[model samples]
Target: MRSEMPYANISGTAVAIPVTGGSLAALVRLPTQLPAPTVICCHGLLSSKDSSKFAAIVEDLCQAGFATVRFDFSGCGESRSASEASLLGTRLRDLLRVMAFVQEQDWNNGQLGLMGCSLGGYLALLGAADSSSVGVKALVCWATPFDLAGIRTALESGNLPHAMATASRQLGEPQDLAGLPPLSRVLVVHGQQDATVGWRAAIEIYRRMADPKELLLFEEADHRFVDPACRNMAIQASTDWFRKHLAGSP
Candidate 1:
Protein backbone atom coordinates (compact mmCIF):
# COMPACT_ATOMS: atom_id res chain seq x y z
CA MET A 1 0.00 0.00 0.00
CA ARG A 2 1.18 3.52 -0.82
CA SER A 3 0.26 6.83 0.82
CA GLU A 4 1.32 10.42 1.24
CA MET A 5 3.34 11.66 4.22
CA PRO A 6 3.31 15.34 4.95
CA TYR A 7 6.74 16.87 4.54
CA ALA A 8 8.18 19.58 6.73
CA ASN A 9 8.85 22.85 4.95
CA ILE A 10 12.35 23.28 6.21
CA SER A 11 13.93 26.71 5.64
CA GLY A 12 17.58 25.94 5.32
CA THR A 13 20.46 26.30 2.86
CA ALA A 14 20.11 23.14 0.81
CA VAL A 15 21.05 24.93 -2.39
CA ALA A 16 22.12 28.33 -3.70
CA ILE A 17 19.49 31.06 -3.78
CA PRO A 18 19.47 34.48 -5.38
CA VAL A 19 18.54 37.48 -3.24
CA THR A 20 15.21 38.02 -4.97
CA GLY A 21 13.75 34.50 -4.75
CA GLY A 22 11.33 33.13 -2.23
CA SER A 23 12.07 30.63 0.58
CA LEU A 24 14.21 27.58 -0.24
CA ALA A 25 13.99 24.12 1.33
CA ALA A 26 13.06 20.43 0.99
CA LEU A 27 9.89 18.35 0.94
CA VAL A 28 10.48 16.01 3.83
CA ARG A 29 9.66 12.33 4.45
CA LEU A 30 6.35 11.02 3.19
CA PRO A 31 4.92 8.15 5.24
CA THR A 32 5.60 4.50 4.51
CA GLN A 33 6.43 1.35 6.46
CA LEU A 34 8.01 -2.12 5.80
CA PRO A 35 11.28 -0.70 7.05
CA ALA A 36 12.67 -0.36 3.55
CA PRO A 37 15.64 1.98 3.54
CA THR A 38 15.37 5.69 2.75
CA VAL A 39 16.84 7.68 -0.13
CA ILE A 40 17.14 11.38 -0.86
CA CYS A 41 17.24 12.30 -4.55
CA CYS A 42 18.59 15.73 -5.53
CA HIS A 43 18.12 17.37 -8.91
CA GLY A 44 20.63 19.27 -11.03
CA LEU A 45 21.05 22.96 -11.90
CA LEU A 46 17.97 24.95 -12.90
CA SER A 47 15.94 21.81 -12.34
CA SER A 48 13.08 21.14 -9.95
CA LYS A 49 11.99 18.24 -7.75
CA ASP A 50 9.72 16.64 -10.34
CA SER A 51 12.38 16.16 -12.98
CA SER A 52 11.35 13.10 -14.97
CA LYS A 53 14.19 10.94 -13.70
CA PHE A 54 13.73 11.97 -10.08
CA ALA A 55 9.97 11.47 -10.18
CA ALA A 56 10.38 8.07 -11.81
CA ILE A 57 12.72 6.88 -9.08
CA VAL A 58 10.57 8.30 -6.33
CA GLU A 59 7.55 6.47 -7.68
CA ASP A 60 9.39 3.19 -7.99
CA LEU A 61 11.03 3.36 -4.55
CA CYS A 62 7.84 4.40 -2.83
CA GLN A 63 6.14 1.32 -4.21
CA ALA A 64 9.07 -0.84 -3.12
CA GLY A 65 8.78 0.33 0.50
CA PHE A 66 11.51 2.96 0.45
CA ALA A 67 10.56 6.38 1.70
CA THR A 68 12.02 9.19 -0.37
CA VAL A 69 12.32 13.00 -0.25
CA ARG A 70 13.35 15.67 -2.80
CA PHE A 71 13.63 19.42 -2.40
CA ASP A 72 14.53 22.55 -4.35
CA PHE A 73 17.62 24.66 -4.00
CA SER A 74 17.10 28.19 -2.70
CA GLY A 75 16.74 29.91 -6.05
CA CYS A 76 15.00 27.08 -7.87
CA GLY A 77 11.56 25.45 -7.99
CA GLU A 78 8.89 26.40 -5.47
CA SER A 79 11.57 27.72 -3.12
CA ARG A 80 13.50 30.95 -3.03
CA SER A 81 15.70 32.37 -5.80
CA ALA A 82 19.45 32.09 -6.22
CA SER A 83 20.06 35.61 -4.96
CA GLU A 84 18.01 35.18 -1.77
CA ALA A 85 18.91 31.56 -1.18
CA SER A 86 21.89 30.71 0.95
CA LEU A 87 25.38 30.37 -0.50
CA LEU A 88 26.75 27.12 -1.94
CA GLY A 89 28.50 26.04 1.26
CA THR A 90 25.43 26.84 3.31
CA ARG A 91 23.28 24.86 0.87
CA LEU A 92 25.42 21.78 1.35
CA ARG A 93 24.92 22.25 5.07
CA ASP A 94 21.21 22.22 4.46
CA LEU A 95 21.49 18.88 2.67
CA LEU A 96 23.09 17.49 5.80
CA ARG A 97 20.30 18.85 7.92
CA VAL A 98 17.85 17.00 5.68
CA MET A 99 19.69 13.80 6.41
CA ALA A 100 19.53 14.55 10.12
CA PHE A 101 15.78 14.83 9.83
CA VAL A 102 15.63 11.49 8.02
CA GLN A 103 17.60 9.87 10.82
CA GLU A 104 15.16 11.28 13.33
CA GLN A 105 12.21 9.82 11.51
CA ASP A 106 10.69 6.57 12.76
CA TRP A 107 10.39 5.20 9.25
CA ASN A 108 14.00 5.69 8.24
CA ASN A 109 16.27 2.81 9.33
CA GLY A 110 19.15 5.17 10.07
CA GLN A 111 20.83 4.06 6.85
CA LEU A 112 20.76 6.78 4.18
CA GLY A 113 21.65 6.83 0.53
CA LEU A 114 22.11 9.76 -1.85
CA MET A 115 21.28 10.35 -5.53
CA GLY A 116 22.47 13.60 -7.07
CA CYS A 117 22.69 14.85 -10.65
CA SER A 118 25.09 17.47 -12.08
CA LEU A 119 26.29 19.95 -9.47
CA GLY A 120 24.09 18.25 -6.94
CA GLY A 121 26.38 15.26 -7.30
CA TYR A 122 29.41 17.36 -6.43
CA LEU A 123 27.74 18.68 -3.30
CA ALA A 124 26.95 15.10 -2.32
CA LEU A 125 30.59 14.02 -2.52
CA LEU A 126 32.12 17.16 -0.99
CA GLY A 127 29.69 17.18 1.91
CA ALA A 128 29.81 13.43 2.36
CA ALA A 129 33.58 13.51 2.49
CA ASP A 130 33.71 16.34 5.00
CA SER A 131 31.15 15.12 7.55
CA SER A 132 30.06 11.91 9.23
CA SER A 133 27.28 11.82 6.70
CA VAL A 134 23.91 10.96 8.23
CA GLY A 135 23.33 7.30 7.42
CA VAL A 136 24.89 7.65 3.98
CA LYS A 137 25.52 3.97 3.38
CA ALA A 138 25.99 4.48 -0.34
CA LEU A 139 26.11 7.24 -2.95
CA VAL A 140 25.25 7.46 -6.67
CA CYS A 141 26.15 10.58 -8.63
CA TRP A 142 25.29 11.51 -12.25
CA ALA A 143 27.37 14.11 -14.13
CA THR A 144 28.68 15.80 -10.96
CA PRO A 145 31.39 18.41 -11.45
CA PHE A 146 33.88 17.27 -8.83
CA ASP A 147 36.59 19.56 -10.19
CA LEU A 148 34.88 22.87 -9.65
CA ALA A 149 38.05 24.92 -9.47
CA GLY A 150 39.34 23.36 -12.63
CA ILE A 151 36.09 24.08 -14.37
CA ARG A 152 36.18 27.67 -13.22
CA THR A 153 39.71 28.01 -14.49
CA ALA A 154 38.72 26.75 -17.91
CA LEU A 155 35.79 29.15 -17.96
CA GLU A 156 37.99 32.02 -16.87
CA SER A 157 38.13 35.06 -19.19
CA GLY A 158 34.70 34.22 -20.50
CA ASN A 159 32.28 36.75 -21.92
CA LEU A 160 30.58 37.25 -18.60
CA PRO A 161 33.04 39.39 -16.66
CA HIS A 162 33.69 38.33 -13.06
CA ALA A 163 31.88 35.03 -13.63
CA MET A 164 34.83 33.02 -12.43
CA ALA A 165 35.68 35.37 -9.61
CA THR A 166 32.09 35.52 -8.43
CA ALA A 167 31.79 31.76 -8.37
CA SER A 168 35.09 31.51 -6.49
CA ARG A 169 33.90 34.04 -4.01
CA GLN A 170 30.71 32.11 -3.39
CA LEU A 171 32.74 28.91 -3.01
CA GLY A 172 34.56 30.84 -0.26
CA GLU A 173 37.96 29.16 -0.38
CA PRO A 174 40.74 27.67 -2.43
CA GLN A 175 40.47 23.93 -1.88
CA ASP A 176 43.65 21.91 -2.32
CA LEU A 177 41.74 19.69 -4.76
CA ALA A 178 43.03 16.76 -2.70
CA GLY A 179 40.48 16.14 0.04
CA LEU A 180 37.76 14.27 -1.92
CA PRO A 181 36.61 11.29 0.11
CA PRO A 182 37.80 7.86 -0.82
CA LEU A 183 34.34 6.54 -1.49
CA SER A 184 33.48 3.07 -0.25
CA ARG A 185 30.67 2.13 -2.62
CA VAL A 186 29.73 4.50 -5.43
CA LEU A 187 28.18 4.47 -8.90
CA VAL A 188 28.98 7.13 -11.49
CA VAL A 189 26.95 7.37 -14.70
CA HIS A 190 27.73 9.93 -17.37
CA GLY A 191 26.81 10.58 -20.97
CA GLN A 192 29.77 10.35 -23.27
CA GLN A 193 28.35 13.10 -25.46
CA ASP A 194 27.57 15.45 -22.59
CA ALA A 195 28.69 18.88 -23.71
CA THR A 196 27.69 20.82 -20.62
CA VAL A 197 29.48 18.46 -18.21
CA GLY A 198 31.85 16.21 -20.01
CA TRP A 199 32.33 12.63 -18.90
CA ARG A 200 35.93 13.31 -17.84
CA ALA A 201 34.91 14.96 -14.60
CA ALA A 202 32.93 11.90 -13.60
CA ILE A 203 35.93 9.77 -14.46
CA GLU A 204 38.10 11.94 -12.22
CA ILE A 205 35.68 11.53 -9.35
CA TYR A 206 35.55 7.78 -9.88
CA ARG A 207 39.34 7.63 -9.89
CA ARG A 208 39.50 9.53 -6.61
CA MET A 209 37.01 7.21 -4.91
CA ALA A 210 38.19 4.70 -2.30
CA ASP A 211 36.90 1.35 -3.64
CA PRO A 212 33.97 -0.78 -4.78
CA LYS A 213 32.97 1.83 -7.29
CA GLU A 214 31.52 1.37 -10.77
CA LEU A 215 31.34 3.76 -13.72
CA LEU A 216 28.91 3.34 -16.63
CA LEU A 217 29.66 5.31 -19.76
CA PHE A 218 26.94 6.18 -22.23
CA GLU A 219 28.33 6.52 -25.69
CA GLU A 220 25.51 8.42 -27.39
CA ALA A 221 23.81 10.43 -24.70
CA ASP A 222 24.17 14.09 -23.84
CA HIS A 223 23.94 16.19 -20.69
CA ARG A 224 20.22 15.74 -20.18
CA PHE A 225 20.04 12.00 -20.75
CA VAL A 226 17.13 12.80 -23.06
CA ASP A 227 17.54 9.73 -25.18
CA PRO A 228 14.98 7.21 -24.03
CA ALA A 229 17.50 4.41 -23.73
CA CYS A 230 19.95 6.53 -21.81
CA ARG A 231 17.34 7.73 -19.37
CA ASN A 232 16.22 4.19 -18.59
CA MET A 233 19.78 3.09 -18.12
CA ALA A 234 20.51 5.92 -15.73
CA ILE A 235 17.44 5.29 -13.60
CA GLN A 236 17.91 1.56 -13.54
CA ALA A 237 21.54 1.86 -12.59
CA SER A 238 20.78 4.31 -9.81
CA THR A 239 17.92 2.22 -8.44
CA ASP A 240 20.02 -0.91 -8.47
CA TRP A 241 22.88 0.82 -6.68
CA PHE A 242 20.62 2.08 -3.91
CA ARG A 243 18.91 -1.28 -3.59
CA LYS A 244 22.12 -3.27 -3.38
CA HIS A 245 23.62 -0.97 -0.78
CA LEU A 246 20.62 0.12 1.27
CA ALA A 247 18.13 -2.77 1.04
CA GLY A 248 19.22 -4.73 4.11
CA SER A 249 17.94 -4.62 7.68
CA PRO A 250 18.90 -1.94 10.15
Candidate 2:
Protein backbone atom coordinates (compact mmCIF):
# COMPACT_ATOMS: atom_id res chain seq x y z
CA MET A 1 0.00 0.00 0.00
CA ARG A 2 1.05 3.66 -0.51
CA SER A 3 -0.03 7.05 0.86
CA GLU A 4 0.76 10.42 -0.68
CA MET A 5 0.44 14.12 0.14
CA PRO A 6 1.24 17.29 -1.76
CA TYR A 7 4.70 18.77 -1.28
CA ALA A 8 4.46 22.56 -0.87
CA ASN A 9 4.47 24.53 -4.16
CA ILE A 10 6.97 22.32 -5.88
CA SER A 11 4.30 20.12 -7.45
CA GLY A 12 5.83 17.29 -5.54
CA THR A 13 4.32 14.45 -3.54
CA ALA A 14 5.37 12.85 -0.28
CA VAL A 15 4.99 9.09 -0.68
CA ALA A 16 5.17 5.99 1.47
CA ILE A 17 6.02 2.73 -0.28
CA PRO A 18 5.61 -0.71 1.23
CA VAL A 19 8.70 -2.92 1.36
CA THR A 20 9.96 -6.05 3.13
CA GLY A 21 10.54 -4.69 6.62
CA GLY A 22 8.14 -1.73 6.46
CA SER A 23 7.64 1.45 4.45
CA LEU A 24 10.26 3.28 2.38
CA ALA A 25 9.68 7.01 2.68
CA ALA A 26 10.03 9.03 -0.52
CA LEU A 27 9.42 12.41 -2.15
CA VAL A 28 8.36 12.61 -5.78
CA ARG A 29 9.00 15.90 -7.59
CA LEU A 30 7.16 16.24 -10.86
CA PRO A 31 7.29 18.55 -13.83
CA THR A 32 4.28 20.70 -14.71
CA GLN A 33 3.47 18.21 -17.43
CA LEU A 34 2.68 14.52 -17.19
CA PRO A 35 4.35 11.35 -18.52
CA ALA A 36 7.84 12.63 -17.75
CA PRO A 37 10.78 10.31 -17.69
CA THR A 38 11.76 9.71 -14.07
CA VAL A 39 15.04 9.56 -12.26
CA ILE A 40 15.26 7.53 -9.05
CA CYS A 41 17.55 9.44 -6.68
CA CYS A 42 19.20 7.28 -4.03
CA HIS A 43 20.86 8.89 -1.04
CA GLY A 44 24.11 7.75 0.49
CA LEU A 45 24.79 5.92 3.75
CA LEU A 46 23.68 7.90 6.82
CA SER A 47 21.61 10.22 4.63
CA SER A 48 17.88 10.43 3.98
CA LYS A 49 15.47 11.68 1.35
CA ASP A 50 15.55 15.20 2.80
CA SER A 51 19.28 15.70 2.50
CA SER A 52 20.06 19.20 1.27
CA LYS A 53 22.07 17.93 -1.69
CA PHE A 54 19.26 15.66 -2.82
CA ALA A 55 16.73 18.45 -2.43
CA ALA A 56 18.76 20.72 -4.66
CA ILE A 57 19.21 18.06 -7.29
CA VAL A 58 15.50 17.27 -7.31
CA GLU A 59 14.71 20.93 -7.83
CA ASP A 60 17.07 21.10 -10.77
CA LEU A 61 15.65 17.95 -12.30
CA CYS A 62 12.09 19.20 -11.93
CA GLN A 63 13.00 22.58 -13.43
CA ALA A 64 14.38 20.70 -16.41
CA GLY A 65 10.96 19.08 -16.78
CA PHE A 66 12.02 15.70 -15.48
CA ALA A 67 10.26 13.99 -12.59
CA THR A 68 12.45 12.84 -9.72
CA VAL A 69 11.84 10.33 -6.95
CA ARG A 70 14.14 10.59 -3.95
CA PHE A 71 13.79 7.86 -1.39
CA ASP A 72 15.37 6.56 1.81
CA PHE A 73 16.84 3.09 1.82
CA SER A 74 15.15 0.40 3.93
CA GLY A 75 16.25 1.33 7.47
CA CYS A 76 17.05 5.02 7.19
CA GLY A 77 14.92 8.11 7.80
CA GLU A 78 11.21 7.40 8.40
CA SER A 79 11.53 3.76 7.37
CA ARG A 80 10.79 0.86 9.71
CA SER A 81 14.12 -0.68 10.70
CA ALA A 82 17.07 0.78 12.58
CA SER A 83 20.07 1.99 10.59
CA GLU A 84 22.51 -0.31 12.35
CA ALA A 85 20.64 -3.43 11.30
CA SER A 86 20.66 -2.57 7.58
CA LEU A 87 23.22 -4.43 5.48
CA LEU A 88 24.51 -3.78 1.95
CA GLY A 89 22.38 -6.57 0.53
CA THR A 90 19.32 -5.30 2.36
CA ARG A 91 19.76 -1.85 0.90
CA LEU A 92 20.00 -3.27 -2.63
CA ARG A 93 16.78 -5.20 -2.10
CA ASP A 94 15.08 -2.05 -0.91
CA LEU A 95 16.21 -0.16 -4.00
CA LEU A 96 15.00 -2.91 -6.32
CA ARG A 97 11.60 -2.81 -4.65
CA VAL A 98 11.51 0.96 -5.10
CA MET A 99 12.30 0.46 -8.79
CA ALA A 100 9.26 -1.77 -9.12
CA PHE A 101 7.11 0.82 -7.39
CA VAL A 102 8.37 3.55 -9.70
CA GLN A 103 7.52 1.43 -12.74
CA GLU A 104 3.96 1.19 -11.53
CA GLN A 105 3.50 4.93 -11.01
CA ASP A 106 1.28 6.79 -13.49
CA TRP A 107 3.71 9.70 -13.92
CA ASN A 108 6.55 7.48 -15.02
CA ASN A 109 7.05 7.41 -18.83
CA GLY A 110 8.57 3.92 -18.99
CA GLN A 111 12.03 5.48 -19.17
CA LEU A 112 14.00 5.23 -15.91
CA GLY A 113 17.28 6.70 -14.78
CA LEU A 114 19.18 6.30 -11.51
CA MET A 115 21.28 8.95 -9.74
CA GLY A 116 22.99 8.16 -6.45
CA CYS A 117 25.68 9.39 -4.10
CA SER A 118 28.46 7.47 -2.36
CA LEU A 119 27.26 4.11 -1.09
CA GLY A 120 23.99 4.71 -2.89
CA GLY A 121 25.95 5.21 -6.10
CA TYR A 122 27.65 1.88 -5.63
CA LEU A 123 24.31 0.17 -5.20
CA ALA A 124 22.85 1.95 -8.26
CA LEU A 125 25.68 0.61 -10.40
CA LEU A 126 25.33 -2.83 -8.86
CA GLY A 127 21.64 -2.94 -9.70
CA ALA A 128 22.08 -1.67 -13.25
CA ALA A 129 24.91 -4.08 -13.94
CA ASP A 130 23.66 -7.18 -12.20
CA SER A 131 19.94 -6.99 -12.90
CA SER A 132 19.43 -7.31 -16.67
CA SER A 133 15.73 -6.68 -16.32
CA VAL A 134 15.96 -3.61 -14.06
CA GLY A 135 14.88 -1.31 -16.95
CA VAL A 136 17.16 1.64 -16.18
CA LYS A 137 17.80 3.84 -19.24
CA ALA A 138 20.65 5.81 -17.71
CA LEU A 139 22.81 5.93 -14.55
CA VAL A 140 24.83 8.50 -12.59
CA CYS A 141 27.05 7.87 -9.56
CA TRP A 142 28.91 10.38 -7.39
CA ALA A 143 31.91 9.40 -5.28
CA THR A 144 31.16 5.68 -5.76
CA PRO A 145 33.65 2.92 -5.06
CA PHE A 146 33.76 0.51 -7.99
CA ASP A 147 36.28 -2.08 -6.81
CA LEU A 148 35.53 -4.04 -3.66
CA ALA A 149 39.19 -4.96 -3.26
CA GLY A 150 40.12 -1.29 -3.27
CA ILE A 151 37.42 -0.61 -0.71
CA ARG A 152 38.81 -3.40 1.47
CA THR A 153 42.28 -1.92 1.24
CA ALA A 154 41.12 1.62 2.03
CA LEU A 155 39.10 0.42 5.02
CA GLU A 156 41.80 -1.82 6.51
CA SER A 157 44.49 0.81 6.05
CA GLY A 158 42.34 3.44 7.73
CA ASN A 159 42.35 1.47 10.99
CA LEU A 160 39.02 -0.21 10.21
CA PRO A 161 38.64 -3.99 10.26
CA HIS A 162 38.82 -6.05 7.06
CA ALA A 163 35.07 -6.39 6.77
CA MET A 164 34.92 -5.23 3.14
CA ALA A 165 37.15 -8.15 2.12
CA THR A 166 34.75 -10.53 3.78
CA ALA A 167 31.85 -8.77 2.06
CA SER A 168 33.57 -9.18 -1.30
CA ARG A 169 33.97 -12.91 -0.73
CA GLN A 170 30.45 -13.35 0.58
CA LEU A 171 28.54 -11.05 -1.76
CA GLY A 172 30.88 -11.61 -4.70
CA GLU A 173 31.77 -9.10 -7.41
CA PRO A 174 29.11 -7.88 -9.83
CA GLN A 175 29.32 -10.25 -12.79
CA ASP A 176 27.91 -7.76 -15.27
CA LEU A 177 30.92 -5.48 -14.85
CA ALA A 178 33.34 -8.35 -15.47
CA GLY A 179 32.48 -8.94 -19.14
CA LEU A 180 30.56 -7.86 -22.22
CA PRO A 181 27.11 -6.21 -22.22
CA PRO A 182 28.33 -3.90 -19.46
CA LEU A 183 25.98 -1.15 -18.31
CA SER A 184 25.35 1.49 -20.99
CA ARG A 185 24.58 5.21 -20.82
CA VAL A 186 26.49 5.52 -17.54
CA LEU A 187 28.04 8.64 -15.99
CA VAL A 188 30.49 8.60 -13.07
CA VAL A 189 31.45 11.73 -11.15
CA HIS A 190 34.12 11.87 -8.47
CA GLY A 191 35.97 14.47 -6.44
CA GLN A 192 39.70 14.36 -6.81
CA GLN A 193 40.01 15.29 -3.14
CA ASP A 194 37.51 12.67 -2.08
CA ALA A 195 39.35 10.70 0.57
CA THR A 196 36.60 8.22 1.27
CA VAL A 197 36.14 6.64 -2.14
CA GLY A 198 39.24 7.74 -4.00
CA TRP A 199 39.09 9.04 -7.58
CA ARG A 200 40.79 5.88 -8.78
CA ALA A 201 37.63 3.99 -8.00
CA ALA A 202 35.72 6.15 -10.47
CA ILE A 203 38.31 5.38 -13.12
CA GLU A 204 37.92 1.71 -12.39
CA ILE A 205 34.18 1.96 -12.98
CA TYR A 206 34.58 3.98 -16.18
CA ARG A 207 37.14 1.54 -17.51
CA ARG A 208 34.89 -1.43 -16.93
CA MET A 209 31.71 0.17 -18.18
CA ALA A 210 30.66 -0.26 -21.84
CA ASP A 211 30.60 2.62 -24.29
CA PRO A 212 28.14 5.52 -24.27
CA LYS A 213 29.53 6.43 -20.83
CA GLU A 214 31.31 9.41 -19.27
CA LEU A 215 33.48 10.32 -16.27
CA LEU A 216 33.83 13.67 -14.53
CA LEU A 217 36.43 14.46 -11.88
CA PHE A 218 36.33 17.72 -9.93
CA GLU A 219 39.66 18.66 -8.45
CA GLU A 220 38.41 20.91 -5.64
CA ALA A 221 35.47 18.81 -4.56
CA ASP A 222 35.42 16.56 -1.51
CA HIS A 223 33.53 13.33 -1.03
CA ARG A 224 30.22 15.05 -0.30
CA PHE A 225 31.02 17.95 -2.64
CA VAL A 226 31.50 20.33 0.29
CA ASP A 227 32.08 23.18 -2.17
CA PRO A 228 28.81 24.67 -3.31
CA ALA A 229 30.05 25.38 -6.84
CA CYS A 230 31.19 21.80 -7.26
CA ARG A 231 27.91 20.48 -5.99
CA ASN A 232 25.91 22.67 -8.34
CA MET A 233 28.05 21.58 -11.27
CA ALA A 234 27.50 17.95 -10.41
CA ILE A 235 23.75 18.50 -10.10
CA GLN A 236 23.54 20.28 -13.43
CA ALA A 237 25.56 17.60 -15.14
CA SER A 238 23.28 14.91 -13.78
CA THR A 239 20.19 16.80 -14.88
CA ASP A 240 21.57 17.21 -18.37
CA TRP A 241 22.55 13.56 -18.59
CA PHE A 242 19.11 12.39 -17.58
CA ARG A 243 17.49 14.82 -19.95
CA LYS A 244 19.55 13.62 -22.87
CA HIS A 245 19.28 9.93 -22.17
CA LEU A 246 15.85 9.58 -20.56
CA ALA A 247 13.89 12.46 -22.12
CA GLY A 248 15.63 12.43 -25.50
CA SER A 249 17.11 15.53 -27.23
CA PRO A 250 15.42 18.88 -26.79
Q: How many Å off is the CA of 14 in candidate 2?
A: 1.5
Root-mean-square deviation (CA) per prediction? 5.9, 4.4
Worst 10 residues of 1 by lDDT: 9-18
Candidate 2 RMSD to the correct structure: 4.4
Candidate 2 stretches greater than 4 Å from native: 1-11, 81-86, 148-181
Tens-place lDDT per residue, model 1, 1-250, is 1223433322212332222334445554443563447788777656777687777767666656567778775545676433312245545655675666667666666778888888678767765676566647788888777566644454443433322223433443323235675877789889999988879888788888877789988998898888988888788878778777777624
lDDT (C-alpha, whole model) for all candidates? 0.65, 0.76
lDDT of 2 by residue, 132-170 (tens): 446888999999876555543444454333222222323
lDDT of 1 at 245: 73
Once model 2 is optimally superposed onto the true structure by TM-score, how far is the C-alpha of residue 35 displaced, in angstroms? 1.0
Superposition error at 208 for model 1 (Å): 1.3
